[model samples]
Target: MARQTQALARICDVISRHAQEGRAPTALPRVRLERVSALTPPAGETLGPSVSLVVQGTVRTVLCEKTSYYGAGEFVVASVGLPVTCAVTGANKVQPYLAISISLQPAIVSEMLLAAPAPRQTTVSSVAQALATGIADPDLLDVVERLTRLLDRPADAAGLQPLYERELLWRLITGKHGQTVRQIGLPDSHLSQLSHAISWIRTHYDQPFSVEELAARASMSVTSFHRHFRAITQMTPLQYQKHLRLHEARTRLLAHADDVAGVGYAVGYGSPSQFSREYRRMFGAPPRNDAAHLRETSAT
Candidate 1:
């Protein structure tokens, strides 16, 4: 038997070092490495369209009501950009959690699909949510293992990263998770439409919009849009907008810890008291207190 091309153990250590550098990319045009040494409490994060592989340890992420578990040798594919609550479910000093995520650019995926002579047909017909997890195949592991090696070589990464990243996506296109990933590129697909609606909401989060407007934009009936939107995102459109506003408020608060009321108003809060109540509800602390704590944490 031939030796395995991808050594999972070595790959884990490589990403661990990258994460330790304190330079984790929030989104990547190509490939990105992420590592976490200690288990952490669940926190909300907005993720782009991507596929993530667990090289070591474990991670648990909850999107809406759906909770996904990824252990070593497993993969989690976020079919579209989504707001999720995530945390390290398992890790230790001996084996820190290491993961690598690659952004799935729709244009690149479409171009690759067109250039291919025969794209493999996806076997999955069931509707997929924002995130799905599946066991990693050996071929995916091999290609991704090769991709990670480029992180250490700047010259090679510039030239060959695209090729390997394409290969990694190709594997997902043909693998069991192919259907879920394919949905992102299907222009008229339900997931794609929801993505469009999500983009609209995020852009105009400060402004009030109605369900009829969103439904029309997505080319979906009011009932259908409402049902599917909640099903896919685990929240109603209004709820999604609230979270988006709250997330933006939090971001702004990190910079101006003193402007709690201004931050709330800027994020679309008409009532300062309502803002404080909701802020406290979501963040587990009032706006001023939370911002102060965050500032204190950064200083120390």
Candidate 2:
């Protein structure tokens, strides 16, 4: 328990330093350490595939309709691209909220799984939602400590970072949520194939495509593709596309304050009224009003 506490403290120290400076203190790619504090609610943001650990205070993340809460000595894993809203639930000037995020590299995961023997499991599936779990084991905490320590020794990072990262992945793969990590790597697995199709849709969401074409890309029958896609992601392919479109439109509106019609067209919406209706349904406000409110909140 003492060792675990020390590990968490060390991680928090590094993240707090980075967050104050608004940039990482290390040269690592795709992984960032941060500490945050806020008195008001934050706008929903899209979190790509990543793992987050909280060293102090608490945070709540909502993915689609599912909500998860993590506190000190706990972690959350998001295995897919999903629209999520997250906020610091417990914070103040002194204690604040300390957290770190490491983006999951699918290729690294795939390589680790390939080099490892298959676990005794029936099948693999997409982990569409976020997962939160407590950290009870000391070994896992040690791996996290070593990873963070690399930031202090940039010279040793190239050789030792990969080794430590692999160990971290191994610990996660053998942990209670092992199946979720495994599903992301297995080729020809239903979840793996669907992830491919989903990735394509996300990248080309601006263009319209038919169900038949998407099914062909997944190499599954149209009926089979539709069923499996929804089963894995909790949303149909079309519904998933709608989520991506609306989320992207929201980003553009917030970033550039783009015109409603222009933002709608930019995200592949041909009808402005349809875009407004869908945006209202997803975000609880029309585009212009929502953007204005967001701007006001940010200013304060």
Candidate 3:
């Protein structure tokens, strides 16, 4: 326990020094450090295959109707890309929110699984959730600490980083959320199959698509596709697409606080009135009003 606490402290120190006001991509491979000094409003983001470990504060993430809160010494893993609303729930000037996120590559996971010994009977829950939270055990924290140390030694990073990453992946694969992490590397896993349709919707969010079309893309029957897609994302395909559109629209509106109708049409809403109504419903304000508020918030 002492060692784990020490490791976490070391990680917090490094992240505190390097993290920016928001997300900061680091020189280390696939690692991102985040720092937030104050509480933040919920924001939508599409989180890809990655594991994020909290080193200093707490975070709240909501996927559809499910809400998950994880604090320091805990980690969240997303086996597939998920559109989630996340906020920094615990932070202050004295104790800022800090976290490290590492992208998980399927190829490396597959290689490790193949080289690993034959499987033991699964211990995690049978029900699969694409996003999950787990307490970081001592082994996992140790591997993460070693990886973070690499940030200070760039010369050694290229040579030693892969080894550390492999070890980290191995630890996670055998940890409590192993079932969800393992699905990332399995081509035939339900998560993998769901990813195909998800990728399409994410890319062509502005385009109209039928359920049958998406089902075929995922290589599953329409009925099965609906079941699996909703199971992982906790939303129907239409709902996911709508969320993406609104999120994108919000971002665009924030960048340029003009063109409410144009932005609405650009994101695939056929009518300006419908767009305004839905935007108000989702964001609690009309498009123009929301955009202005967002811009004001950023300026301050």
Better of 1 and 3 by lDDT: 3
What TM-score, to 2 decimals, does candidate 2 have?
A: 0.86
Alpha-carbon error at 128 in model 2, in Å?
A: 7.8
Worst lDDT run of 10 residues, candidate 2, spans 123-132
Error of 1 at 144 (Å): 1.0
Tens-digit lDDT string for candidate 1 (8-50): 7667766765666222663224577776666755556787778
Candidate 3: lDDT of 57?
Answer: 87
The order by descending lDDT is 3, 1, 2
Per-residue lDDT for 1-300 in model 2, tens only?
898888888877766655662225347666676555654354466556667778788888765666777788888665666556666788777877877777777788888897776665543342433343556368887888788777778798888888887887888777777666666666766667777688898899888999999898888999989887776666777877887788788779987675999999999999999999998987788899888887886676
TM-score of each: 0.83, 0.86, 0.93
Name model 2 segments beyond 4 Å from true: 1-3, 21-26, 39-44, 114-117, 122-136, 255-258
TM-score of 1: 0.83
Report how far off residue 130 is in candidate 1 (Å): 2.3
What's the distance in Å from true for residue 298, model 2? Answer: 2.1
- Clash count of each predicted structure: 0, 0, 0
What value of lDDT does candidate 2 attain over all alpha carbons?
A: 0.74
Overall local distance difference test of candidate 1: 0.75
